[model samples]
Each structure stands twice: as structure tokens, then as C-alpha cells.
Target: MRALIAAAIGLAAALAVVLTVTAIGAPPGETSPKPLRTTVPEHP
Candidate 1:
């Protein structure tokens, strides 16, 4: 029982470290400006 609890704690700690590292290294979202749309005549 003690061994199982220890293993679980170790696994949780490893996962937490991995998640923290990934979150910190992730890229930022797009911030570029969009082009303006011009009105065009409709064709029949």
C-alpha cells in the first residue's frame, strides 16, 4: 500500500513538471493586422 502511494505521488510530480515546462515554452497567438475590405459592384 505504501509503495503504491509513493508511486502515485512520483508520477504526479513528474507530470506537473512536464506541464509547467510546456506551458512556459508555448508560442503566442497571432497579432497581425487584417486588410481592409473594399466594396465591389455586383455582376449579373
Candidate 2:
């Protein structure tokens, strides 16, 4: 039970990080299903 809870917490944290970075650092037009692995560009 403890292991399961730890795994869940880890997964949640990882998901939160991904979402935070995507929402904050990603560009404005990443709604499609192709560019899920985009990198931060140099400038606008």
C-alpha cells in the first residue's frame, strides 16, 4: 500500500511538472496532436 501511494505521488508530481512547463514555457499554438515534443525557441 505504501509503495502504491508513493508511485501515485510520483506520477502526480511528474504530470504536474509537465503541465506547468507546457502551460508556462510553450508557445501559444500547441493545440494540435503532432508537436507534443516541442523545444523552447530562441526568440519570437
Candidate 3:
């Protein structure tokens, strides 16, 4: 269980680093490579 938790934390850290780098290097006039966004439906 300890090992599993460590692995999950490591993976999350690596992913965050990669995403930050990608966002910084993204070219102007282009959308983000991965849109970390969510949308909600409108109600009447």
C-alpha cells in the first residue's frame, strides 16, 4: 500500500511538470495542447 501511494504521487508530479512545460512552450495564436477545462450545462 505504501509503494502504491508513492507511485501514484510520483506519476502525478511528473504529469504536472510535463503539462506546465507544454503550456509554457505553446505557440501564440494556438490553443493549449490539452485544454484542462470543464463545462457545465445551463439550466432554465
The lDDT values for all models are 0.90, 0.87, 0.89
Candidate 1 lDDT, tens digit per residue, 1-44?
99999999999999999999998996779766986659786889
Off by over 4 Å in 1: 26-44
lDDT of 3 by residue, 1-44 (tens): 99999999999999999999998996669666996748875779
Worst 10 residues of 3 by lDDT: 34-43
Better of 2 and 3 by lDDT: 3
Candidate number of the best lDDT = 1
| Per-model RMSD to reference | 9.7, 10.8, 7.6
Tally clashes: model 1.
0
